[model samples]
Structure formats: structure tokens, C-alpha cells
Target: MKARFPDRAKLRAQVWNAMDNNPGTRMPAFGKYQALSEAEIDAIVDYLYTL
Candidate 1:
């Protein structure tokens, strides 16, 4: 997690920021860039669960 395990709220915000706030933005730090990154998501989820 690198000491940055963002919570559900943060995750939602990232997704929203990419979809709404940015609208036309690409390479977003959220899901779009990481949308297909199930490995990353799973890793983060696992780390967050420990906290």
C-alpha cells in the first residue's frame, strides 16, 4: 500500500474526479487509468483491509 491505502471515500472520489470533475481527462489517477487493474485494486484492497 506504500502507506497510502485510500479508503472507499477516496476511491469514489478518484473515480468521480476522473468521470465528473475532469470529464475529458485521461491517464487519471483513479479507476479509468486503473480501471482494468484488478491486480492493483486487489492489492490495495488487501492492504486497506489490514488497516
Candidate 2:
């Protein structure tokens, strides 16, 4: 199996703290984040299952 990332809350925190170009989302916009596509979100379901 592939390596799993962090959990939902954890992932959200990570993404929130990460780089997000969108103003409506993310706290800090200057790390490693962007508008995640539907497929990408699907792939990260485990990480965002709670939301």
C-alpha cells in the first residue's frame, strides 16, 4: 500500500498553514497548498474524510 498522509484535522491544519493562493481559504498563503481538484480531493479522501 502507499504511504498515508496525516488525518483530516491534521491535513486541514497543514493545508491551512500551507501556501494557498485563494483568499477565501487557507490562513497563510505561501507554503505548499493550492486549489485542490475534485480528483485530488478524492485521492485525499482519507485525509479529509471528516469534512
**Per-residue C-alpha lDDT of model 1 across residues 1-45, encoded as one tens digit per residue:** 325534555554544344555666674554455554656665665
Off by over 4 Å in 1: 1-29
Question: Could you tell me which 10 consecutive residues in candidate 1 have the lowest summed lDDT?
Answer: 1-10
Looking at model 1, how many pairs of residues clash? 1
List model 2 lDDT by residue over 1-51, tens digit each.
Answer: 123444454454445444333546536432244566445544665545544
Model 1: residue 1 alpha-carbon error in angstroms: 14
- Scored by CA lDDT, what does every candidate get? 0.53, 0.46
User: Any runs in candidate 2 off by more than 4 Å, and if so which?
Assistant: 1-3, 19-51
